[model samples]
Target: MLTTDSNKATEIRQAAAKHHGLPLLPRPTDDERDPLRWPRSLKLAALIATAFVNFTANFAGAGLSVASPVLQAQFHKTPNQVNSLLTFNFLLLGVGNLFWVPLGVKFGKRASLLISTLILFAVLVWTAKETAFAGLLAARCLSGFASAAGESIVPSIVTDIFFLHEHAAMMSWYTILVSSATAIGPLVASFIVQYSRGGWVDYVWVCAALAGANTVAIYFLYPESNFNRPKEPLHRVSVTGEDADKVQVVKTETISRHRVSVVSKSWFSIWTSVFTINREINILEVALRPLKMLLRPSVLLATFIYGTSLASQIILIFAFPSLLLAPPYLFSSSQVGLMQIAAIIGFSIGCFAGGYIADIITAVVIRRQTGNVYPEQRLVALIPGCLVAPAGCILIAFACSDKLHWVAIAFGFGMVSFGTIYAPNIAITYVVECYPRVVAECLVAINVFKNLVAFLFLYTAVDWVASSGWTQVYMIMFMLVSLSMLLAIPFYFFGPKWRGQVDISNVSEE
Candidate 1:
């Protein structure tokens, strides 16, 4: 038995050193243990709780549209002015990541998650109660700021917890929640406002209810997932010796023993972890890291891909309600809400398929390229999605402009939703893998770029479509999206060369 255990540990150490250029395992502090080492059920519970919080945050952001008309009537605000609610909220959502992500880096993820969720809950309550338009807008700004945690911080959380092979599928869940929340928020909110006497207030209250539930769930379920392992390899080795040619061998029995011991901590001790900060964190360095990463070719490529993909979705969010309310279709708010269900279906398919497809395609590419997976292999997965997304945009433009059947319009919307979904899941997984040392910073850059691009679309989309006609407006979007995705071609081929140029000195694991 002792000899077998020695051989297993030797194989793991050799594999880790050969493949990862790092240690088999560090002398872990209480918080420095890998989250993957946790029991399967505990890790799964953590994922579900985190995803629910993500859903609640996005649900709040996307539901603002359903409340716009009632808000306009009550406050005598113009449609354009009401739209500013989304505009400013999105702006804050992007910019807020600069601060929130750094704080997550400086403090533990559980602390950051708890603090943000609590703030989101309070803002939702204020949004529910506020009668003044200005007050409501102010509340949403804070809400967006707080809710930035879901997009910017959660992906890093996934990276911290899951292994490289699991990232694509795990990230797909985050992408799905974000897209589904955007579509479903309006579907649920439109009906509530249309039927309930409480109107917009009722919708806000629903968001608040979900927010409260998410807060409690997170408090009970989410533990600190950040684990800073040593750069140097461990000195210990198995008696059997090194097998550098083989893949890493993880010993399940050994990990299970560690899980049993570590996870047995009391609930009170876990709760107090919200106040724990990463002692190695340098706040100033954390604030500046994303900006530096923005200059990297791989990072910039992800920005364009994710940013353009997000812009297409934002345009649809604003366009659907405006267009359906006017002209031949003359749909009610509830009907318009139902129209978004098409998008939900598309997003679900995209989210579910993107993960597996990316993983499979990447594996194939890896086998062909070097018999070892490279981060750039993930780019191949985006090719199909890139082509499909632009085509979907063109379809939407033609369908809406030609006054085609509602089914035609719905199909176009779904195609666009489905196509756009692929870009983020692939891009995020690729980039995170590429810069595991600075996952938070890379995500902050991506969010900032994506949100800024989406903000531009939000402000210009309605007017552009109205003035240029849907064909012209969508054609322009298609062109931009195509160009962005095309950029991936060069990266797919030459990404390693570009990545080699990056200055690792700027990267801090803390």
Candidate 2:
């Protein structure tokens, strides 16, 4: 086993000999240590794989929008049929989280990340060879399922590796990879479809490269975080009657469960001890945790923000190519792709700003409260974006029909992209902080619900946004944003109350 720099080799030694009767295992030698240093190497490791995952997943999902017209002609299908591709992508993407999240916990997180990337590699290869539209849709759906594990577990990995002081910052950086990739997705897809002689083959190539690079980097550079390792074993001692008052010598039983997994394998499991409702829980209760988690307040708020904010993107995916290609713009698929660059740029800035800003705001709140920080404090940063998102949405709505400088419309859409990621990032950080015990489950449910919202909107968003016009749609976005802020207001004030409830409810493990 490679233990990074923690003298993990020493810990494994102590653990094996601690009367646990676990088999001794070989450890990595000096040559295997990570030689790369710093915010530079660490940032590269954290951002690069995440970016690759985002790039691949986004291409698989939204790349087709640029080629919708051709796909329709080739398949002899309707607009709605083309729309199913997006709907199908979102449908399984939401639910896929449930299966992968538990696996992430059961296996080590490192293994889960590697497993998903490998699956993605195979799926994309399959995608490139398919001619039938139905086959392509199925490939995309499977890709979404494979991608969900990466999306659900990434925040957890960030939280685990980085210190509490750095959690929001790192989380935000990762969020940028997501939000920017999303905003930029169709733009890249459009151009690829326009230029490639093989038509959509280019999309597959892009994902293939991204996934391949990420797989290589993760296998080499990514370390198993300290939080992921089993807990320190409990030390047991014995006493002599003559020295009853004095400490005794005895064997220690570590919290590290006996490698009930003595034999290494692709998949592994062990009995996990959990406390639920102050009752000692078996593996069954913990397994069932994701089912009930959707009902929690933090989760619902996360879902609302996630679902509502992402609906805006789905609208663009369905509408943008049609809007730009039909009008006075009359651009090629490549030009339409270039149009998305504005939104991508805006979203990139917004994602990075939101990540660091949310962290800073939460830090300030934490310090003011004397180390007793409320997770809702992160929500405070989202309120402004909530208000701004609608305004931007309305602008895009009006510009879409009015047919302004075209640049104006792009700017409006860009603002909407920025506004969307701003709050969602904070919402993500806050929700996880609020429910750290079920981080993977909470994210899976949030993504699942959010994906449902996207699925619903993708199938119908074109009609909804166009029927309502940019103006009416924007107004509706405004209302939702207001609702989010109003909902969040309580969080700022009563966040401490909920945190207290959670703290009070948690019994000491001893």
Candidate 3:
């Protein structure tokens, strides 16, 4: 065995094993197979593939919102009935993760992702071809289920491959893809509905084509990121000369013994293994883990903060077609589609502002505190999002009620879109950092609550605005969203302490 002076070893570890003065979390080992130790090129490729699938998933789900008018005319249905397609889809998008995430935990993320992508492709095609309204609704529901893996598993893959310090920047890219897809989906669908002879069918087929391509890409390009390395014991080092009488034990965050591979498994064998379930993992417990995580104060707070931000965007998507398609606006499908450009710009700016900029600010805060880093430090970034999003909602209400220029409504949409990316990026990064071990389940809980919140608002938003008037309904939403975002203040101060109160060791370790 190799040996060094205890003090010298500690110094070396401290100097070499830190990022921005913070210790490397879930510390990496020497094993080549460890994702932390993977090459930069490989890591980037995985991230790209993951982001692509995420975009395709959200694109498929939200793109249809732009086609609601066409669908209503084709099926002779009311706007509320047309809106149900998205409402029920959002509901299952959340609840479906309860099923898919457990499979990811028991099998592997690659398997779960591949399986879901295939299902998504099939459902998208079914949606394109379905003639009846009820049939299309069924296809939409299945598409939501297929999309769940894309939302929940991508975060786990991010955590598996990247260290804590890299999460904010990386998650920013992920969130930008997701948010941009939501905006761009409608943009693309609008053009298709206006220009393409196939109309709404072409939009669904576009998503289907992307999903099919992503499935093939995943089969070859994506590697299984799930690796369960056993924990290592403390490294004990001896002293020399005058300090020989004293010994010091240095604790590591996590360490693993390296093993040489005598045989390399075939790609076919590796692919086949993804479906093999590890019997040691309790399927039932894994399935129910998200529900238990929902009870944690940190998780609950993060969910509401993230959920409300997302709901703001969903409300805009649901309302835009009706608002812009009628009255002084009388916008064409293509013009309405152009509206998403504002949201895309907002998402792009928010990604950099909240993601890369936040990481830099976090480093500054860590340095000021002499290398101490807390998850709460990230919460500071949510402030701008909280203030801006509700303000945007208020702007939209006024713009619509007063019949202002369409540019005002677009600008308001941009502001709301900014909040969707900015606040949720921090909220998600914070919660995942707080519960790093249970990332898969934590994300499941977050997505479930987020989607449920969107579903409840969307299910009632059309009727509410019809009954209560746009000004009153949106004012209430603005207040609710503002109150939800404000909760971050208390969480920033007490979140760390409250996180300690919840024990996830049993579920995470298992």
Please name the candidate that would achieve the greatest TM-score relative to the true structure.
3
Clashing pairs in 2: 233-254, 233-255, 234-254, 394-474, 397-470
Cα error of candidate 1 at position 330, Å: 1.0
Q: For model 1, what is the C-alpha lDDT against the true structure?
A: 0.76
| C-alpha lDDT of residue 375 in model 2 | 65
Model 2: residue 351 alpha-carbon error in angstroms: 2.0
- Put down candidate 1 lDDT per residue, 223-328, tens digits, no spaces: 8777774443212222221443333334333532222233443468566667557777788888888898898888888888777877887688887877888888
Total clashing pairs in model 2: 5
- Off-target runs (Cα >4 Å) in candidate 1 are 1-32, 231-269, 504-510
lDDT of each: 0.76, 0.64, 0.78
Between candidates 1 and 3, the TM-score winner:
3
lDDT of 2 by residue, 180-271 (tens): 66656677777678777877677777777777777766666555431322222222222223332222222224323322222221111111
Rank candidates by TM-score, best first.
3, 1, 2
Can you list the residue pairs that collide in candidate 3?
none
